[model samples]
Target chain A: MDEKSTINKDSENIERGNNIEVWEDVVNIKDLLLSILICASAAMGGYLIAPDDPQKPLLYGLVGVVIGFLVSSMIIKPKRTLRFEDEEK
Target chain B: MDLSLIMELIAISIFGAVLYTIIGIAPGTDETAVLMPVTLILVLSGLQPISVLAFFISSIVAKKLTDSIPVAIAGIPGGVLSAPMVEHAMVLKNRGLPDVSIRKMASGSVIGTLIAVPLSLFLANLLIPFGETISKYSNEIFFGGAVFLALMTKNRWLALLSIVPFALLIQGLRHLYWGTGAVPEDTTVFTSFFLGITVGPIILKLLELLNKEIRSNLPRRTTNDIVLKQQEKVKGFPNPFKILDKKETGSAAFSSVLGVFTFFMSPAGMTIFLGEVISSRIKDPIKKATRAISSMDGVTNAAYISGILIPLIAIGAPLSPTALGPGMALFNAPPVFTEDHNLHHILSMGDFIVATVIGAVIAISLTYFVTVKYSQQICTFVFKYIPHEALLGVFLALVIMLAYMDAGLINIGGVILIGLVAGVLHRWGVNYGIQFMVLYAAPWIVGNLVF
Candidate 1:
């Protein structure tokens, strides 16, 4: 059946013709620095908001979110490209 | 330990594995969501740390194989870990290798688990001191990780867009759970995480439902084609590792190194980056045979296992969704389990090592046998019996129920609204990951700025 489909079907592959590439880490490292600044600034800001106030839970959660964002950003880099550049025949 | 205690441990392992199997089969759900409720139960049950570790491993390995099934049968993905698998599965499906691909994954899982055992233990030993030293600067390290992710994305707006939404969603859901504490006293962290994962997709699906342009533009569901082109050349014993080359070997090695960085990063993201980089470098002609393709899955499993084990042994960081599931076994083991200095942590380590080896063996061994015997049957069955739209519909409903189960009906409704907003954002070529990052990141930023 696969043979039949391949023969009968258009040679066009769904995944074909697109070239996705990964960015170099040098590029990624920069993004990591920026993300950290944003998150830490955010977290430190949260810590400042309720120095000793109620809603410790919310405050702590805010801190965690900042950390999570910073960490997630650092850990996960963007895809280079979804598909590779297609070569024209 | 008493006989009953041993029996309980066995039960936990079995239960964990079963739950993992379910997670593996289901696309939207992940190990974290699966393990959340289970973790609560373990904490309450007072299970021994070693036994809890065993159960966690069993479930994780089971999911490794099961998760590949959906990606192979349907383009719809399952676990966050399985995203790469989806790409490969699509390739296999076109080539009449869907069953073969699933088997490869299973084989990969087993191989990964086995290889990870000693590798993780060795890495854990190194990470222990490193973790202790880095504890003070964990904040800086994690922050650096975030920035690295943003810049790596290439498009700054796309990166921020993806990162922000996820951060906010996590924070918002966390707040919603906390808010409910005054009312029902039932809201918990497990529910909050579950709500986040479940609601995101459900909201996305709802948007797919609501938007007229999208609804109209949705492609007509394609019928499954089960017949295959017979190829004798494709048959015979193929070395599973035969696909690796110099470039992919490099990525795999990098991924393995990054695996140890869980103290400040997500291994899943690292795997994607490594795979992407390798994919980017491979000039088209060499892409398929690129060692990175094979290594992507291998390194991911390696990284994932290492990520979990390092944290467990080092600073007791339950980082991976799987590790976090059995979190109590590491973080809060009772005095009886560890009367001495952090002996319970060692117990978690031992279990991780053991489970990794066992899971890897099981995944590889079973995948091979299953693929050999039933690949054709399974593919044919999927094509003949399963309706693509029905499968999608089921997934949609599952996502909603999963969210509802986490934070109550109100939270589910909120996620639906969130998903619609996300859908609109997605239309603008913004990324899903960056959005998720934002949702996860926002609360802290907001609090810090306000305070």
Candidate 2:
């Protein structure tokens, strides 16, 4: 009985490792966290290091957000796989 | 006014149109969250006000046109406003007419933009004389709007019950900031709180994932496959009238008028209400669905335009829901635009008209054409390439950065706390419109609360 329960627990762990939905799209939790980390650091880092000029910080932050977005896009593959089907008729 | 300025306006309009068309097709992107950060940045960057107006108008038009693409392509809403059309869009998708659904919706957007622009300008002018009275009672009006929207919600009781507590929570945070000297008493922590509300659901969901029991129990799937039907390419520039039949056009036009009239109401609510009322009598499911989607798209687009335009042209404050949300930057981005000094004060009537015309025309020409011609291809590309992680990352970064900018590090924690509470309220059916109204009326509600 103990052996059987261990096997069941192993199967549940595998299931828990799979993709989960967020904001109407499937995503791996690890990737989500990584992307968030990269982006938050980039954006905040840009904001922090900028000269005290009001516009400079915001502009740098905006650029940082874009950079983070591009980096994340290159690093993380989208969970969705698309398949196309021609019209039968 | 000048040739160089007109040239700059045209260029920015194109930029706005191109940028939003892609963003609009990404599923589940909230209208405000994606639109506001960039707009806020632009405003704070000290760009020309006329140019900003042009960009905003174009962005709205482009976004409205393409947000329905995902609904037609994959049966998921691209934004909150597109959620209402999903049922009807699914109808057409199931009927093997996804392209048709997209074309109809895009055409409907064209009609909406066309009708809404002049009519909104005219209506704004008509109300300009009353702008004084309106701004004087703006706080009371916002409070009343919250109550009215609460009453209209599905869970009216829960929504109504949330108003006072939510108000207290907002004002409580503000008072704390003032007392601790995190910010001056007069410098309201607006932007971060606004971003916090937008990020609420995500924050809640992220926190829930931290619980082992919840994490283990979440339903998981190995493959998240999206099947796209092969669509025949349109050879020429598609005309809006050609895409929509007479009955569809008429209903869309009629709904667009109603959308303008109900400018102060929630666009999503207006879309569902008007879409259903207009299409209820039709017998055929496919026909009914098409009609409904066409008119629904029209209502949202019209409501969006008028929502921003009317309040902007009439009152300098963020009075309407659109103004309060995505268009807030135009009305009240601090140090640049305040309630007292915004587009309404800065731009003349001619400037408004010129900016509106340039933005609307460019967006319609560019986005409408692309939507009819290549919605499937572009949607497939976005789905295949743009990870949800990246989008969510950008959203997260925006909120955190803005929170830090508002009152420093402590305000970040404050924003998250606000997000948690707002997320719970959101999950419980207190809609953004109601929450936003509460945000606007918080100081008033707290100050006027009787012992």
Candidate 3:
């Protein structure tokens, strides 16, 4: 009975650990996809709107993608900050 | 105004006030989401300009007053602007003083609007001489305003950098629309972009369902019950002035005046700023919280009224963030009213004043009476009977349909894309004010530099 209980506990711990790892991986992927989507959509927007010239659309689209990349990189991720007493209640 | 115009204004005001009051009670229902489409439809249907203005002003006033109902009772904010009121409201709710809080907010709203309209009218008149000159420098002003708003955010540097990219995106889309040889309507492009930005957070959250782990972790409400204390029935014709004390009334009036003058500032930001400024002076915690809530309510109404009125009356441009955002249709509706010839050109000052005053009086009187008398009943019904998720789904559907109708099927895709991108920026602490400024200034930025 004791041996069986110990084995069950070990399995539960492994499952929980796997779940956490999977959650983290999903979050990372979501973040990456968000960035990529923003960049690609911006490029597409430029291409669609670019002046009637065929080559100009492509050039504008590339420029848009570059700007999107720069802006996304500049985004400041939110952080948890400890507050002191002086802050507004 | 003629008798026919006067009658029309009254009819429109009543309709708008009733419709918007109901919409305002439902938490998460945005003023813009409802106002934009409705105003567009009304204008397109050949409603008189004075009547449209009357409808627009009354709807806003009624909505702002009734929005406090959800916040004070259920602790769920009615909209983004009401979010700041929730903390103070929850405090009162936990103490079994929600009725008191509700009365305070409702009263504050009434007094605030009463103070704001005349003051804004006076200010608008004062600024009219410089209207043409101001409009001429709008491009430069927009650029400067964008930078100023960007720097006011938590992620200042990031927001500053974002302006260029956002501007580029808007210009690109505009170009694409024009390139298609479509009848050249700027409103269609802007509407989609605005809708995209407004609904971005919800889109991102929905998209997160792709991951089962994330979905499992999402918070779920177990029950929909909201408890409230019973109050004595008040006699006929409730007076808002009697409910609030001298200090609350004074503070609210002062804040409303401040809000009227600071027309360019974002309403939500102004609410917080005024609330904190008013509350901090009080030493007692309870008094501070209550006063803050009341003053915040005052600021909300005052800011909205002034923000819309000043710009519309003065420059005939959607200059303020509030005007540019929820009130965009008023300034620019195509095939009938365009940016070049808007409501300012169509309606006289006398018409604006009469419509606004009559609309405000009727809307506020009705909303205040209903709120003060039936607070508990309304709260119970909304929380117990209404399915929150179903309401959200309906609103989302409406938004999608509106986006499709305004732009094209392709613009629906554009809306989602913009929503997601803007949603990411929002989650990272970049605010709506900066986004709006960037959107409004994009054309000027591209015209001078990019071209």
Candidate 4:
């Protein structure tokens, strides 16, 4: 009976660990997807608004893409966490 | 200034003070929303330049002072500028000392204004000689200010990086509007952008209610009873000096002076920055919190006043974010006070100085009286009768209406899109200051880089 209980506990621990990993992965995916959407939409917006000049549209679009990449990277890798407590103190 | 103009100034100041006090009492009403429309009306109505200046200055002062009431008692910020006071005020509220907190804020505002006026006037006079030179490099100045503001945020690199996307977003919208063969008013377009950003977080939270998972995880109010300290009523007019301790008074004055020099920075940023600086030097948490709250209020008033006064008196342009945002009408009221023919051109330096001082004095006096005597009753009334959802609904409706008025149907869509983007960034701790800087610099960035 003791041996059986130990085996069940080990399996439960593994299941919990797997759940945590899955949750983290989901969060990361959400972040990446949001970033891409923000960037793509911004680029599309620039392209749509640019004048009829062939080169200008492409250049504006490229600038938008660069901007999007920078924003997304920043979102993905935040430099520091903000705390309300810090301001209060 | 003439005698009739002086009388008109005083009358306008009083009217503005009373109107803004009521508006400031209600949470969710932004200074820009109130100031812009009213100033535009006054300007279009053919009010004298001194009268308009007096009205604008007094209204802003009164609003900033009374904004503390909602922040202290109910833990709801009166507006974006007042949001920083929530945490510190909440500390005092939980301790059943909200009365003390309100008193400190009110006193801080009054004292801060008293000290900032003369100093700012002096600085404005000194800076006036360089205004012409500065205007030439306004584009560079805006870019530098944007970069500096981003670097000062909590997540400096993230903020700096986000600026690129934000600026692109703004420029894209501008270009799109222009492409339609429509002459878009810069003020109207920017106003829509401002409203969108201001209401972004609320819109996001409202949308979250549609998701069951998010809704269930959200914190709900568990109680409605707001317990406040019941102090004995003191007779006659309340003195600010008596309410604030010597050390607290000193800090408030010092921070106010410092905030005057940073008029180009966002008022919200200055409040938090000054509060943190002051609080970090103190040892005890409770004492630190109290001092920080007072000085933060001080910074809010001082920064706002100096921001408007300095720019108007020195540069005759909306150089500071405060001037460009809430005080925009004073600089660029179409058909009446265009950018070139603004108050700076019409009013003399003597008129500016006298009107501002008179406006500040009367406005602060009235606000201080109302705030000190009836703050508790006001808080109790708002909390007991005013529904939070109702306030949110009204504000949302107002913003939408304003956006539609600004640029018809297309702006409404633009406002929502901008709101969504800003909402995401704000939730991640990117502040309005950085956003404002980016918006202001967007034209320059696009002109130099893309075109």
| Local distance difference test scores for all models | 0.49, 0.85, 0.71, 0.74
The deviation in Å at residue B413 for candidate 1 is 1.6
Least accurate stretch of 10 residues (summed lDDT) in model 1 chain B? B220-229
lDDT tens digits, residues B29-138, model 1?
55554554455456446665566566656666666656667666564565656654456566655555555555555545545555665777787787777766655554
Tens-digit per-residue lDDT, B357-397, candidate 3: 97898798777888888776776565444433333343454
**Best of the candidates, lDDT:** 2
Query: What is the Cα-based lDDT of residue B404 in candidate 2?
Result: 89
Pull out the clashing pairs in model 2. Answer: none
- Candidates 1 onward: DockQ, in order: 0.02, 0.44, 0.02, 0.02
> Which scores better on TM-score, 2 or 3?
2
Clashing pairs in 3: A49-B175, A49-B176
* Model 4 C-alpha lDDT per residue in residues A1-89, reported as the tens digit of each score: 35644553454344332111110011122343455465565555555577875345444654554465556554442111111222334
lDDT of 3: 0.71
Candidate 3 is graded, for docking, as incorrect
Off by over 4 Å in 3: A1-89, B1-5, B74-77, B87-99, B172-188, B219-221, B280-288, B447-451
Q: Count the backbone clashes (under 3 Å) in each candidate.
A: 55, 0, 2, 0
Docking quality category of candidate 2 according to DockQ thresholds:
acceptable
TM-score of each: 0.67, 0.86, 0.76, 0.81
lDDT at position A41, candidate 3: 62
* C-alpha positional error of residue B329 in candidate 1 after TM-score superposition, expressed in Å: 7.6
